[model samples]
Target: MPTLKINDVEVKVEPGTLLLDACAQAGFPVPSYCYHPTLTPVATCRMCVVEIKGQPKLATSCTTLAADGQEVFTESPAVKDGRAGVMEFLLINHPLDCPICDQAGECKLQDYSYQYGQDDSRMVEPKRRYRYEDLGAKIVIDKNRCIHCTRCVRFTKEISGTYELTVANRGSNLEVTTYAGRSMDENPLAGNVVDLCPVGALTSRDFRFNKRVWYLKPVPTINRHSPMANPMWADVDKNRVWRFRPRPQGTQVSTHYMFDEERLAWHRYDLDPAVRVATPVLRGAPASVEAVAAALREGATAVVGQGTFGCDSAQRLGDLASAPELRYGSGDRVVQIQFPALQLSSDGVLNRRGFSERGYRFGHLDELLAKVKGGEVRSVILLHDEAFSSRAEAAKLREIVEAAPFSLVLEPIPGELSGLATATLPVTTFLEEADFVIDHEGVLKRYQKALQAPKGVKTVAAWAKELAAATQAAHA
Candidate 1:
């Protein structure tokens, strides 16, 4: 451990700890642009320069390691001037597009400029400009707004290892672009560059100009599309999710970036109100919860829960089954990606561990189907997500539903399985329900409700609890 004094405060940190981190731990977070914890520190931005007690000049705190008995000043006049100078240099070629830039509210450049930049520019020369270039179908590069921090360039080369992006030209005319004619569409992690950009240089084609960031409230959530169940922020507005962005969990590298497919899956949650099943139904006609509960209680019940749902839902749904052995897990969607380092598992089921912990067995759907056909199971209750189900699984599940005397399905969106059910209940989607899951790494992650569920729509846990109560009353 090394003891260091930051702004008259003494702190002890590990020998290899960066001065920037030590300062942060000492309650003085130095401003930075190109210093992501997961990435190698390039110290190109110079925004985190600090005055050392014995050094002749200010040092970039991000690249400097703390030494025993070292003294550093982050708020001194010299450090302030250094940061302001860097801000001025960065803004020299950077255009004034904050009024229309998508990164306005949350951009590091905007925040740093307000805190460290001069009121006016000293450069009398005309600012450089270039027409926006489309890197691929997924990303667009606006050269005018670029500060040349090269965060995106480094991300593509170092983190993603795609090497599709590069810095073209030199110094004053430097630009980040694709190789020759190759586009970034092939890169599954292309959307992350937009997040790495400190300014409005890189933008997502899907999310560009769709909504102002200030109006969107970020709700902490997890990405169910990935087996890792990576932490994320669901940017919601007017009770609708607009986008999903990586919400880094501490210094965990896996949570720092997400696949582009998972990033765009927010559209699935922006469901149409007319298409959603808002109430319980019996044989395609609207019915009451009590009637559906009555139907469930009359037969030998079993549950087939999709492993992508939360553990609480899985546990509650398991109780609805006539026997503990009747609880089955069904989700066979696997995401095949070239980069295995970024994806923890090819298995797309996010909550397989959660379901397994709740005694829901996977890969036994065939046995369950056979039992249903043999007249051992008289009724089936299925908890499903259409996105996670394959055609084969759907077909097998549909066969079981049809063979059973009665079937009850709890689905967020009506699909083939729901259509075959003798009784159907509307369940809240992940974005509309608060629950937790054990991810691929055995880490428990909780997600909060980001959007409001439709009237009469409830979570699987709530519905199952109600159904259990109804069954008990009927037996009494």
Candidate 2:
């Protein structure tokens, strides 16, 4: 450990920790555009300069390591002047179109300019201009607002390993662009570059000009499409999710970025609560939860819960089975791309470990099917979502449901098996409920409710409790 004084406050950090990070630990954060925890520290922005007691020149805190007994001043006169100078040069050719820019409210250049920049510019020459260029169907590049931080270029090279973006030309004409004007559509993680941009130079094609950043409130959530179940923010307005972004956790580099599929997965959950299925259906007609529960309790019942659901959902679904061993697991989707840096597992089932720990047996669907057809298990209760299941796995589940004499399907979204069941109950989606899950590393991650469920819709846990009580009362 090394003890350092940042802005007159003493702090201790592990060895090899960056001075910029140490300063942040001490509550005096030195801002920088090119210094991301996940990316290499380029120090090209020159915005994180700090004055060292014995150093002759102001040192870049991003590249400097903290040392014992070191005294660093982040807000000294010399450091302030240097930052103001850097801010001035960065704005020399930058456009003043913040009103129309997508990054207006969250742009670093705008914040730093108001804090450390001069009100007037020294250069009278007209600002350099270039028409916005589309980097394929995913991103749009506006060179006029660029600050030349090279963060996007480094992201493609280091994190995604796509090497699709690069910096072209010299000092005054430096521009970030794709190689040979190639499109970024082939890059599975291309949308992350837009997040790395400190200015409005890079914008997502899907989200640009759609809505202002300030109007949307970020709701903490998790990526259901990811195997790691990475945390994310669902930017919602008026109960509609507009977009998703990586929610970084502590110093873990993998949490700083996500796959494009995960980034855009929120669209699948953006259902119209007004039009969503709000009531239980029995034999293709409207019915009550009691009716569905009565039909399911006719004989011995077996439960098959997909591993993509929350731990609370799994616990309640397991209780529907006649015995503990009657609980089965489902879901067999696998992610093809294996980005070793970010993805922890290739299996797409997010909460398989959580379900397995709750006495839910996986990879035994065939055995369960045999028991259902042999008149041992007369009824089946399935808690499923089709998005996380493969066609083959879905076919197997459909067979199991159809073989049972009385089957009750519970789903947030209606699927093929839901149509085959004797009865179906509409449940609230994960976004509309609050629950937690255990990841591959046994880490308990909790997600809060981001949307309001419809009037008649309920969570799996809530529905399961009602069904259990109704069935017990009927027996009594």
Candidate 3:
């Protein structure tokens, strides 16, 4: 451990901690652009300059390390003046596109300018300019607004390991661009550069000019499609999901960024309420939960739960099984991921560990099918999501559902198995319900409900409880 004095206040930090981080921990965060916690710190921005007691000149806090008994002043007169000078240089060639810029409300450049920048510019020369260019279908670059912080460049090299972005030219002509104007479409994590940029220079093509970010309320949630179960935000407005952004956690570099697949997966959950299955259907007609429950309780029931769902849903689904051994698991889809640092497992079933902990056995759906066909398990109840299940797994599940004398299917969206189900219940999507799951690391991650389910839609847990009550009443 090392002790330092920030603004005359005593602070202790772990060895080799950056002065920038120490100042932040001491309650005086310095402004920075090129200093991302997860990325390599180049200290090129010069906005985080601070005065040290024994140093002749102000030092860039980002590149400087805290030492024992070091006296650091984050808001000294010289440091403030140095930061203002840096802001002046950064804004010299920057454009005045704030009104039309998508980053207007949340831009770091705008915030730092007001705090440390001079009231007016001293430049007599015209501002440098370059027309906005499309990097690919996923990203757009506005060179005119770039401050050459190189955070995006470092992200591509260090984090994504896809060196698709680089700085071209030098000095005033320096610009961040793809190699020989190559497309970024091949980079799966290309969308993250937009998040890395401190200014409006980089933006996502899918979210460009869609809606002002301030208007969209960010709801904390997890990436259900990701095996890491990465925390993310569902930016919603008017009951519709507009976009998804990575919700970074403390010291977990993997949480700082997300894959483009998970970023764009919000569209699947932003389903149209009008077209969604709104009510319980029994043999093609609207029915009550009691009717569906009675039909499932007709004989010995075998349960199949997809591990993509939350643990609470798994626990409720397991309660429907006639015996513990009758509980089967599903969701065997595998995804290909390039960045190993961002994701450890490629298993598409994010909650497999959670379901397994709840007594659901995976990789044995074939046995359940045989039991159903042999008349040993007279009824079957399946909780499935077609997106995360392989064709073979889905087909096996379909055979079990088809073989059972009576079947009940619970799905947020109807799939192939829904057609053969003796009864069906419309369930809330993951976004419409709050629940938690245990990941491959045995870490419990919770996600809150982001959207309200349609009038007749209910969560799997809610439906399961109702069905259990109905079964008990019948016996009573």
Candidate 4:
């Protein structure tokens, strides 16, 4: 262990820790654009500079390892002047187009500049300009706004194993681009570059110009698309999901940035007003939420809680059934073998463990129906969404569901299962609900709703609570 003082505060960390990280541990985060925990540390950006005792010149905190008794000053006048000079240089050739830039609100240049940048620029020369070029249908490159951080270039080579991006030319003419004339479309993880870009250099084609960053709100939630079940920041507005970004859990274990598929999965939740079941419905007739809940309780002698739901929702929904054993687990069966080293888990259901923990039996739907036929099970409460299952799995699920004496379906959006259900309730989509996550390993992570549910719908937790109160009264 080594003890170091950063800006008058002393903190103990393991030997060889970076001064920039030590300063952050001491409660002062130096501005950095080129440093990422997952990639090799490159202090080329000159953003994370700090004043260390006995050092003649300001040092790059990212690459400089803290030694025992090392006293570092991150707020000294000299350090501030150096940082300002670096910022000025970086912005000399940069375009002042934050409004049109896709990274507007979450852009590092915007945030760091506000915290440690001059309000005015002194550059008198004409700024360099380059027309935006399509890297692929997935990502676009605006070379003029690039800061030469090389994070995206390294990401393609190291993380994605695509090696599609590289630095061409040198000095003032240096530009990050694809190899020769290759496009990034072949790469499954291409969208991650947009996130790796410190500025507006790389942008997502799906997200650009669709909605301004500030207008969208970020909701913390688990990625149902990955095997590790990585947490993400799902940006949304008015119940429409905008985008998904990696919401890292500190710097300890690296949470690899999400892949292109995970990032673009936002479109699955873009609920169309016409397609969405705005309110509760029973056999094609409009009904109140209360009426749906009542019918579900009356019909469901058994319950099926899908693993796709969050932990709190799973617990509450599990309580709606006759007994814990009556709770069945169902999801679209998935078989994915091309496991990219990234968080690309083909499991599809992020909260499988949570449902299983509460006694929801998966692969036991046949037995559940037998119990139903024997009159041991009367009602079935289903927590379902259609995105994860294939056609065969769907058919099996449909058969089992139809066999139940009483069937109630809860869907974030209406699907075929909901159509055949005796009663259908509008349940909260992942973007529209606040709850906790239980990953494959049963690790619990909390998340909050990003958008408001449409008119008459409510979250599964809310519906289950109402059902439980009524069930107890009826039993009495």
- CA lDDT, every model vs. true structure: 0.89, 0.90, 0.89, 0.79
User: Which residue pairs in candidate 1 have backbone atoms (N, alpha carbon, C) closer than 3 angstroms, thus clashing?
Assistant: none
Model 2 score (lDDT): 0.90
Off by over 4 Å in 4: 114-122, 252-256, 273-275, 287-300, 332-341, 344-346, 372-378, 468-476
Better of 1 and 2 by lDDT: 2
* Residue 303 accuracy (lDDT) in model 4: 74
lDDT of 4: 0.79
lDDT of 4 by residue, 97-202 (tens): 9978888988999888887889998989898776555687888889999999999988877777778889988888888877877899988778888888889898
Per-residue alpha-carbon lDDT of candidate 3 for residues 1-476, written as tens digits (9 for 90 to 100):
89889999999999999999999999999899999999888988888899999999999889999999999998888988898899999999988889999898999999999988889999889998875666889988889988999999998889877788898888777888888777789888888988888898889888889999889999999899889798999999888999999999987988888888889988788889889888899998999988888888777998899999999999998998999999999999897867778878889899999999989999998898888888899998899999998889888888888888889998887888999899999999888999999999999999999889999899999998999999999999
In model 4, residue pairs whose N, Cα or C atoms come closer than 3 Å (at least 3 residues apart or on different chains), thus clashing, are 226-345, 227-345, 300-379, 300-380, 301-378, 301-379, 302-379, 332-389
Q: How displaced is residue 311 in candidate 3, in Å?
A: 1.0
Per residue, candidate 2 scores C-alpha lDDT tens digits across 289-371 of 89988888778999999999999999998999999999999999898865787877888998999999999999999998999
Off by over 4 Å in 1: none
* TM-score attained by model 1: 0.97
